[model samples]
Target: MHTDLWNYALALYARPGVEAACLQLQEDGADVCLLLCASWLQARRARVSDERVCALLALAEPWRIEVVQPLRTLRQQWRMAAQGDAALALLREQLKGLELQAERTLLERLQACSQQWPAGSDETADDWLVRLAPDLCRDHGALDQLRAAASALQDAEDGD
Candidate 1:
């Protein structure tokens, strides 16, 4: 497993079903960056607590709202326009890269904030997922899928 949060995120996001699952969670008001951070923490075997989860969200929420989402919205909005206009397609691609960088930055900051946290925990990956997105649990199917994906990521990391 990659120790750097950005690399870890890229690898995890590429896994089958993860991108779609993350988008579903995001549409349900979950912060995908924080979720990725939670996954990273789980991969590292970090102790998770409500307080720690709250603190990480506090650090990530504003930037995600102000910087990342706007870029994402604009990039998505341009999808139709970009399909026909070559120049527009080029510019949209650039915005997509910027949006990705913004997310990468958020992940880096999350990693920095949690660097001092101690590892060694018996908590399952679902424990962190539940703590991070409690509301999602209301949808059992979605929550179960997310938990499975997260657990798979942790299992893969453990094997590395």
Candidate 2:
């Protein structure tokens, strides 16, 4: 299975626009390690090889350690700094635009993935959306936008 999926990844990687999307996603901080692993899987087609996946996960260790973990720490710090509801409210408004930027980056990544992968039926790549849905919706109505985008894609595909 891993072998097949690796071939699929190669096919996907070779797809005309995929490399550009991949590069942009990397620039957007979409977890290069995970992207590499997914790319491997997409090329190979079969289930990803455990050994390869493990090695790649190990490589991503630093990203988790240096990037995401620190961000979590900072979020905690921000919460603590709020002092009270009014302060929290002020911080929330101040951070809204930054949050929107992050969401846009993520949604762009997801749309790129959908464009590369087949979106027919239940096989659409739902896992990515599942992981991000909560954070994208946490502070805004972006979930509705996401849902609408997804719905439009589904409808368009169904029409085809």
Candidate 3:
């Protein structure tokens, strides 16, 4: 299990089905960075309170909206345009890297904000997931899949 948030995120994200699960969660308005942070916290057995969850979201929302999403939108918008022009494809790839870096920055910020919280005995990954995305009822299936994937990864790491 990696102690650093960024490494933990990369390893967890590389798990089977996790990428698609994360994309599905993102489509439902969940912040993937926050979700990854929550997974990290859960793996560490950290305390997950409503207040802390809210605080993490508050810290991450602005960055996600202003930086990550715009780059993502541009990359998506350029998908077709990049198909014909080699230069456009190169530029879109660059934007994609920027978007990834922005997401990494968000994860770092989130980890820094919550690093002081003590581990709790009562909360599960599902608890963090629900608090992190309260409106996830719109797609219960996707939410459940994410919860399962995160929990599985955390459990795997903890068992190591």
Candidate 4:
């Protein structure tokens, strides 16, 4: 049985350094959701292409900018005030949850977009990440950490 993208993301994110790596990537203007999808695609050995990447971006960019980014911005904006105010902290937590949910929904949409693409690719093993990751993140050690974690996650699952 194949693992769905959400679960795969959760498991991968739970891995050591992955969360930090993702955050670092996000800081560098990379989309964590896109990176996760890239890792998942590589793990599944799915084919990678310009059209497929474009399709994923086309489906995800608006949702990220309009939905995820706003919630995340609000949460970040409240970080300091929320630190001192209990009620504000609660609201910020709620906002954080909403942001998470928005990202999850984006992941689900991405999965749906690529679900029909068959596993097994003519592309190189790293092609998915290489293509999907932001150029700014291309040489970051955080990116390497994510790549390592994804590989370890794939090995652990295959061992199951």
Best by TM-score: 4
For every candidate structure, what is the RMSD over all alpha carbons to the true structure, in angstroms? 2.3, 13.0, 2.1, 1.4
Candidate 1 lands at a TM-score of 0.87
The runs of at least 3 residues in candidate 3 whose Cα sits more than 4 Å from the true structure, single-residue gaps closed, are 120-126, 137-139
lDDT ranking, best first: 4, 3, 1, 2
Using lDDT, give the best candidate's number. 4
lDDT of 1 at 2: 77
TM-score of each: 0.87, 0.30, 0.89, 0.95
Once fitted onto the true fold, the runs of candidate 2 whose alpha carbons sit more than 4 angstroms away are 1-46, 83-160
Q: Summarize candidate 3's per-residue lDDT along 30-89 as a digit string, tens digits.
A: 888888887778767786676887899889999999999999999999999999999999
Give lDDT per model, in order: 0.81, 0.42, 0.82, 0.88
What digit string (tens of lDDT, one per residue) describes model 4 on residues 46-147? Answer: 888889999998988899999999999999999999989999999998999999999999999999999999987766744777788779989889988999
**lDDT of model 1 at residue 87?**
100
The sequence of per-residue lDDT tens digits that candidate 2 reaches over residues 1-160 is: 2223333334444544555654454444445335534433332232333454455455445545665445445555677566667877576556654543443343344334334433223433423322322242323333233333334433443474
Summing lDDT over every window of 10 consecutive residues in candidate 1, give the lowest-scoring window: 134-143
